[model samples]
Target chain A: MFDTSTFIRLLPELILLVTALVVIFVDLYARRRTALGLLPGLSIVGLALSFLAVFAQWGTREVVAQTLAADTFAAFFKMVAAVAVILVVLASVRYMRARTRYVGEFYAFLLVATLAVYIAVSARDLITLYLGLETLSIVSYVLTGFLRDDKRSNEAAIKYFLYGAVASAIMLYGFSLLYGVTGTTDLQEIARRLLNGDVLVNMEWLAWPAIVLVTVGFAFKASLVPFHQWAPDAYEGAPTPVTMFLSTVSKATGFAVMARMFLVAMPALQSSWTALLYGLAVLTMTLGNLIALRQTSVKRMLAYSSIAHAGFILMGLVAVTTALGQPFNGLDGVLMYVVAYAFTNAGAFAVVAAVEDGTGGATLDHFAGLVGRAPFLAAAMLIFLLSLAGVPPLAGFAAKLFVFAPVVRQEYYVLAVVALINAVLAAGYYLKVVKQMFFVEEPERAPFAVARSMRWALWLMIIAVFGVGIFMNWFAFMASQGAAGMLGL
Target chain B: MVPLSWYLTVAALLFVLGLYGVLSRRNAVAILMGVELMLNAVNINLIAFWRYTRPDNVAGLVFAIIVLTVAAAEAAVGLALFIALYRLRETVNVDEIDLLKG
Candidate 1:
């Protein structure tokens, strides 16, 4: 069943896996100075190749090796994951080095985590998806506490681990229920059986409960409200670069698998799941923003904001449908939003990393006069913040437009309105940082100078934010294609 | 042969019990133990379903085995994290491990 063609479809994952292993071994033996430069460099090269592997498979739409699909949908999310990783690694170089001596292992773990997400989105069945998510969780737990000596980091990791382990176990129970109902672990087979009514009615009722239990897992990963207690602490405690990874790439992975599972395995359960997601969307958006509004710490504020963005992303899933060519077909908005948010959010966190690097804290006092201290960082922070607040001429605006349009089309006017209000609510906090940077008097300190590598990554993120905004129509179309391509459009 | 329903009921009860432990336990290791119990419940559920409905198919068995492996891996990582936390604060009680509150 598996052949050379299948291998090409699997190439991105293979390349990343090998790179992760090689980096670990190389770091073990290489001199410290050489290892530091070589590890990040090797990781970027590996990720760039993986991104190309995904790009090259852009139009190929087929299930490979029975459990993995090499389609545009997976490729789109994988591309987003790859881009997010490369940028984080570049931005991470100096930031991570300062926090820990095991910089090489950090790069290796990052690669492995990326590979896990790639597997997750591409998975066509329950087993592969479960394993992929668990791997990501295990690695993320370690990364969250990478600052082994730091009490806050350790607390965050253990909290994250407890929550994550419980969520995944609960999800596995759901999978077992689905397996029992359909007598199969293949997602497509389960969907077909459910749709065909092959299972007894009592047995059929199992799928609903199964779906609810599984959502608990996805929600924890996405940090939806109620399951989101770990997020703010983790985001506040982890080293800033790891926080960037957790918020952007890791969060995107959660959405990727959730979207693929719903769109692929539970198309028959659309009406039910949509209603469920609609409630979640409202709670996640409202609660996330309300908590964020009062946060004094900028990092904690972003954490809440990211949870709200996940809620916004969930709206696309709620309004999802097969009505191709309709503007804001729900899935496209999810895909577009994931891509746009990854770049914009990572950029915002990078600015956090830069500020925290210099000031040793991300509190308001630390950022009292950021513009005067580090003019370029303050300027970049302005762009990232505006984009996040859904201001026009930026990626966040485009992302919000597509996702919000679908909610309106789906007649979820209440969700749309809550989101719009949340956007405004969210802008209040994002702009708070902007005001602090631009308006506050310059604090007493030496003028800041960002690391050269981080400066380059920041420039790339700025260009992407503008490029994604101006060329939104094209990205929107690509998102449409990716969503449509999953169903063989 | 034990009926599938019997296994299902037992596993579900075990899962709820484990969930209670997770919610009620203060020690991080105890929480990890709670999670292990829940995972074991899932495995029991998987195997029972396989034996009852799809005994000829190895998918269920494979899934159960994989879950077993993953649970071990998760426990390993969880314990390591707890050790690190314990060293820092001299306790595994999660309530005291609160340096990250807003």
Candidate 2:
């Protein structure tokens, strides 16, 4: 059951698992406050190394033990997860230091959670997939409530846990139905059986229910509409760094898993699910943007905006339609969108974390006249906000271009038009934040200093946003290659 | 010999009842218990399917075992969250834990 090739294939995950264990041990011994600095340092080193391991495995494709698959698609998302976690840890150094005492578990769980995402995206078996999802969910619940003293944090964690448990239970029930119908937990095997009509002839009616039930779990994870109530509360209540991770890395994982499940395992049921996703996509974007228009708190507004972005990404999936073994451009668009979004959303939340550190407020008024106090931060936030609004020459605009191009190419005019309206609605809210930071004036407090690690993280995110924006052709090509590899095209 | 449909019917009823409990209950612990009931229903479905359809294969059995293990872990985390909520707000009522809104 075990072999050397499997170990080699999982080198990145192995390094992360080892690093997580070491962080726990390090935390236990480093009781002094000064020694706490080493934890985040070690965590970053671990993440960077894990990133290198993934890079080394590029272009390698193999399935380990009929459960985990190592391929470029998994490698691409591993890099995204690693980069997001590194940025979150860097941003967290000062934020967590200022708020809580359990610094070690915070860093350790970050590594563990990153590892879980790797497992999740690579899973080819239902058992492995479920375990990876639960691991990510559990670690996230703890991380959300890291500040035990904060009532908001505690309440957020409770809500997240309650919602998470029920969602997972429902998903498990779906898995059971699927397993019963197919008689195997291997995803590809199930696909083979369903495609060859070995299973469907006897159980055709069960397929739609199974697909709908499975979508419920994924929709919850991705914060799709009607299943998205927990997002704003969890995002607003959690620590800003955790909020950054949740919006970017956590959401990216959901999309990654959703793409894999739909494109790889259940291609037989594509027509029905794509139609379902079309309706969900329209509702998610409209509701997410319209509600964000009324939010007073900047954090809560970003939370809703993240939901709207989820809708944008979902648009790519809804447009996917393959024939004659040719790969769908919609999947390529989705892959690019996920990478671009990881940087943009994380960068936006990092700015919020820095501002929260400077002033203990999170409302729109807190950002007034920000340009005067911190020009670099305000400039960076401006770029991120513009990018999010899909302004030209930014990552968000590039991402939106890639996603909508395929929908238009496929002659999906109605989806394209609805998306255009949603884009305009999204810009309205994002521009309001820009107006507060640049135009509105409040000159009462002294200029504040951003922490060293936070500054470095912000610069890295700024570079990524521009780099992806300017080199759109190169990144799009890479994303398409990864998407093609996923489909074995 | 019992038919497969009977087991599925009972499990579906249990799952529906659990879902109703989860949606209607206000107390956090009670909601967690509802989640537990839902998981148990899943376990029954898994075992029943395994015995009737795939008696020669071990995948279904292993899946049920994993589900049981994961459900316990989920309960532990849920209870810990409830205890944390109690310590913060002096009550485990989910409705009262609304420090965040709109």
Candidate 3:
């Protein structure tokens, strides 16, 4: 029954796997020749090819051997992951070459990370899911410490590894419990068993612990409150490009998996799970914003703000319901919000990377008089900051409107108001960066030079932020379709 | 045949001990050991459930094998990170690696 179409359907993942292998081998042989410059070009081509593959598979939905699926939902995330990886690779080109000796391996790891995201998002079986998640996590740890000799990078990697291992172990234990009770490792099968009221009748008491343990793992990945200790250290310590990847793609991957697992499997426990998420959503936003407001370092502030954004995204999850009629009503908002966030956050971090490269510092003091040093970067940072603050005519505003629409529709007035206030509180820190860039007096040095590749990446992101905002209806429709496809609507 | 409750009880105890180790231990390696203990508990749960529920299917056995492999990989990464930490600060104690604290 396995046909050529099966392989064809997995073209994006296959292309990514081959690209990673090629990049790895190319690094060893390229040496210090002019050929070294071609590595990034090849990686970009690989990402583009995969993006096309996802496009080709856009409307096709099929489960392959009960382990993975080639559905519109997977396609949607594949495109997101592809865009994020491409932007990160573009940002890394000059940055990685300037810092690290192993340029080829950096690009290779980026591709592998993207490949892992595809696998994780497409996984239909629990084993496949775990494998994908671990692959992504491990690669991410390696990427975080790519600057091996730097103490900060090393510390970030270890802290991330320890926290990640413990969290995944806990989540796996919860998975084992679920498999033990339901006697199936397939996600859809687990849902069937639990919701049908046949398998978990006598074992109803076990379900709560299983869900709680699993949420711990997901919360860590999403960097939600109470499990958010790693974000600031990891974001500040890693190379800025890797931080961009972690903040945007890594966070999106976590949300994608979380949405799939909670909405698809064990949805029968919605009442209990939603209540828990309600509390977590509030804690994550409030704590993240309060802590962010006190941060001095710009990078650490962005890290904390990312956590707060995670809380806002969780509001979409809380708005979800499995009442059999309104499928994916809130989920569409989650997908749109994450995609919009990827553009805005990645664009913002790209600016940080550019400034750090120019000034050798990422502190607010170093950012003083940036308007005179680099006018384009200052303007771009303003765009991204305004977008993050949810100003109109920007992607962040559109993202908030889409996600909060569902919450308001569901009559979650308190949650929506809390999120609104956090957004306002968040603007204070974002404005600090803008104030440093625009309002401070000019430094005496020659104008700082922006790398050609870094400039391109920022421009692309600027386009994406404004493009998605202006084309809100089309992207929102695509997100709704992706959400509907995920639920088999 | 061993009772399912007995296996589950031991697994729960192992998991609890692992959580305690992860929480209370200051040394990085010891905390990793705690994580290992927790993963081992999961393996026991998976295998016990498989043998008791349905031995014909190999999914449980397969899942346990994957978990074992991933655990080994995780340990290798963990140790590598610890070594990197030691090279930087001359210590593997988590409390000592506090340079990035807010």
Candidate that scores best on DockQ: 1
Q: What is the TM-score of each candidate against the true structure?
A: 0.99, 0.98, 0.98
How do the residues A63-90 of candidate 3 rate in per-residue lDDT, one tens digit apiece? Answer: 9767888888888988998999899988
TM-score of chain A of 1: 0.98
Model 3 residue pairs with clashes:
none
lDDT value, residue A82 of candidate 2: 98
Fnat, one value per model: 0.93, 0.85, 0.76
For candidate 2, give the lDDT of residue B45: 90
Q: Clash pairs of candidate 2?
A: none
lDDT value for model 3: 0.88
For residue A463, give model 2's deviation from the true position in Å. Answer: 0.4
Put the candidates in DockQ order, highest first.
1, 2, 3
Candidate 3: segments with Cα more than 4 A from true spot = A322-328
DockQ for model 1? 0.88
lDDT of each: 0.90, 0.89, 0.88
